[model samples]
Target: MGPYSGSKSYSGGEIMGLKVFFSVLAVSVAISGCAKSPPPAPNHLIMLTETADGQADASFMEVDTLEECESRASAAKKVFPMAKIKYIRHYCTHTNIKFEPFLHNPEPEGPSYVFGLNFVKDGKVLSKVSNFKSMTDCENKGKQVCVISYQNIVPGE
Candidate 1:
């Protein structure tokens, strides 16, 4: 038998090698198509004034567009009516903020806020005072950290 007599084995190996190479190429193409796109630019901006201690001083609002950023500053006069608008920040994008179909609170009559004061000593929660009606009430308890939780429900138009 000549060298060509065993050519079936060589051709079989070549076919198997080609199949493995094509399989890897197909997987790489599929993964590239499944890659996530970058997030879109923020559509709305939030303006707020900061206190000396870097905390927002009762002034914050979300705007619709970049052009209205200046006009919104004038509108904020009704909230503070004295404090000037100094800090403007991009907060939400069109894709990020989605309207909920159902209401958070169906009745919407009782206290809509829950404030809690937590005292932590050496990475441990020593004591926690919760269920305060307002921020001032939670502050009166006097803890290292205060956690405020509240949700707003808007009726469908």
Candidate 2:
């Protein structure tokens, strides 16, 4: 039975072409199946406040959208008419000290973590917020004055 044998015959080039076609098809399917999903959007808003002396206060509110975050800020302003409120995002430091909400030390030898609505201010961050650590810390700084507040960008609900 010649090269046909009982069925058909394929040349060396034709066999290689078939193998390459199937290999490519399989790879495409595998890659498509492994496509990564996008990251989730922000869904919670954090409200942070700091007095002139440097003590800070923080609160978190779940929000569906940016508009909802703003709405909550408006409501908060009504309750705290004297506060200077702004909107920002919250990112934790490697040490995650900001969440501690307590003084690392009266005079921090290492970096101080700042837990407030606005972690960044005027070109400064946690270390420069002041020596104060909490609301009580601010009171200790001196006579109370203006309270600076921030509404953090919406995060996970």
Candidate 3:
């Protein structure tokens, strides 16, 4: 009422309304202030890729020693007994999104694979290839002893 508006006195109705609002606000803040459980952490994805001739080459991976490329290929074979998935299981993605290429119609947001492999059984690193992020770092850039041509690298090759 500083000359900007008509003079007024607090009313019982207005005071009650203000009290109700403040009460609700105080309750809300108290409840909200209670500790909350944190969200679950994300899962880590592990991809698979083939290597060859001590260099990272998707093509050469096809030619890797049976003991070199897949650590679980044999385990998979043992499960089915007659499953000859030398190259079938050779290609795998950590997530379902990676199986797009084999589909008749692939979704645009196909799952990607980021993998680098060393022969766990054979104790030899034929090659390593992975997600688009690591390709440049792991791709064979050397002319020393390329089993497959340096230019043979491809996505899921």
The candidate maximizing lDDT is 2
Give the better candidate number (1 or 2) by TM-score. Answer: 2
lDDT assessment of candidate 3: 0.36
lDDT winner, 2 or 3: 2
Candidate 3's error at 19, in angstroms? 0.9
Expressed as tens digits, the lDDT of each residue in 65-108 for candidate 1 is 54565566556545543544344322232223222232223233
Point out where model 1 deviates above 4 Å.
1-10, 51-53, 57-83, 86-88, 95-157
Can you tell me which runs of candidate 2 are displaced by over 4 Å?
1-5, 47-58, 65-67, 70-82, 85-157
Indicate whether candidate 1 or candidate 3 has the larger lDDT. Answer: 1
CA lDDT, every model vs. true structure: 0.43, 0.44, 0.36
> What would the per-residue lDDT of candidate 3 be over residues 1-157, giving only the tens digit for each residue?
4785876778999999999999999999999898574322211112222342233322222212334325544454465435322222333222212212222121213333333443321222323433333444435543222122222234453
Best candidate (score: TM-score): 2
Candidate 3, poorest ten consecutive residues by summed lDDT = 40-49
What is the lDDT, from 0 to 100, of the residue 75 in candidate 3? Answer: 53
**Stretch of 10 with least lDDT, candidate 1:** 93-102
Could you list the CA RMSD of all candidates, in the order they appear?
11.9, 12.2, 14.5
